[model samples]
Target: MTAITAPMAHRTRLRLTARGRRLLTAVAALPAAIALAFAVVSGGAALATIDDGAPAQSFATVTVSAGDTLWSIAEDIAPTADPRDVVDAIVRLNALDGAQISAGQSLAIPAEYAP
Candidate 1:
């Protein structure tokens, strides 16, 4: 008589509970959260850096006239320099909104063009 044998084809699937899934997700996100926090904390250090090596710039004051524009002022102040460069310097020095300047507005000219 031959003995009958069962075929070994049984497979088991691994399943995680809701709490286990949440714990796994938290573990996965912890490193990314830590990295973001570290970046934010480290970036704050750059904001307060003071450059003591550079000397404070000196500026010459000029009052705007009724028809004076940045281009015209730039040309009048620095005839030897490029008007665009002079205009950009003037705008940056005065923190102007644009090329617009009202009458009687005092503007600070860069020291390079001071005369």
Candidate 2:
């Protein structure tokens, strides 16, 4: 009797419609889900730190004037950072490819990129 009722219910059910809405929602949530999963997998095991209400850091923004070289900019941003290391940090910070940079741009000055 159960088998007969199950088959009848399956056959009588109307096919649910509308794939576009569901697909749109899934696509929108993909990036957030990926970020959450990455954070959880990467840092979930970390232990607690002592609570401190210190003011958050305010990062400085340096504008690139005309004819400003990357080396000069990097040096100014990271004075103590090694030149080679600063170059790598600049590339990563400015999101550059092949040491490319244009004038009249702005970039964040990272304190350090540890070895």
Candidate 3:
């Protein structure tokens, strides 16, 4: 005589549907996406607050004369300094779209380099 017994199963397997897998993946990625966005925003704000440690620049107005070109004006204004830098500064301070200047136009000059 022989005894027969049914085999016992130790654990059940889990199978997820395609939709369930996609939903689970999205949920898992949501936290990472939020964290990345937060890092970018905070980094930008921190960068905005960082100072270059340079002093504030001051400006003075100069009226252009009949023979005053940017080069001549910059040279007269800052003889010992670089004329190119002075001219660039003048252009920026006055917000001139081009190098063209009329005789009566007033231009802003950096105070440190002003005559």
Candidate 4:
């Protein structure tokens, strides 16, 4: 013969009050707030020191004239160096968008190619 069992009682759902919900939100946000604070504090120092009085290297500036191109300018400035290499150096040093340069615009030549 099998024994009879009693039915289980229903449990009520846990309801959070306003204060409890605010405390829960604060707890969840605590770590993120602390991380942001640490980042702001620790990032406020100089990672490396460099002497600001004297520059390590200086660049020579060239003024682009009418009818002048990078190839011609590079040839004129650095006669001993290859015009293509000089042009490439000038483009990179001046942060040019392309080989296109306008008249009267100033460009910085790399020290190696500077006259």
TM-score of 4: 0.52
Candidate 1's C-alpha runs over 4 A off are: 1-57
Candidate 3 has its poorest 10 consecutive residues by lDDT at 47-56
Q: Residue-wise lDDT of candidate 1 within 44-81, one digit each (tens)?
A: 44333333422356788999999999999989999999
* Model 3 C-alpha lDDT per residue in residues 1-115, reported as the tens digit of each score: 8999989978978989999999999999999898779769898554444554223456777899998899999999899999999999988877788789999999888888966
Candidate 2: residue 107 Cα off by (Å): 1.5
Per-residue CA lDDT of model 2 for 1-115, tens digit only, reads 3554434544566564579678878999999998788768867333211243212342345777888777877676666877677777666755677565668787655545322
Clashes of 3: 0
Cα distance off (Å), candidate 2, residue 7:
40
Descending-lDDT candidate ranking: 1, 3, 4, 2
Superposing all C-alpha atoms, what RMSD in Å does each candidate have to the true structure? 10.1, 12.3, 12.3, 9.8
Instruction: State in Å the error of residue 81, model 1.
Output: 0.6
Once superposed on the true structure, which residue ranges of model 3 sit more than 4 Å away at CA? 1-57
lDDT of predicted model 1: 0.85
Best by lDDT: 1
* Model 1 steric clash pairs: none
Superpose all Cα atoms of candidate 1 onto the true structure and report the RMSD in Å to 1 decimal: 10.1
User: Model 4: runs farther than 4 Å from truth?
Assistant: 1-56
Question: Which regions in candidate 2 have their CA more than 4 angstroms from the true location?
Answer: 1-41, 44-59, 113-115
RMSD of 3: 12.3
Residue 72 miss distance in model 2 (angstroms): 0.9
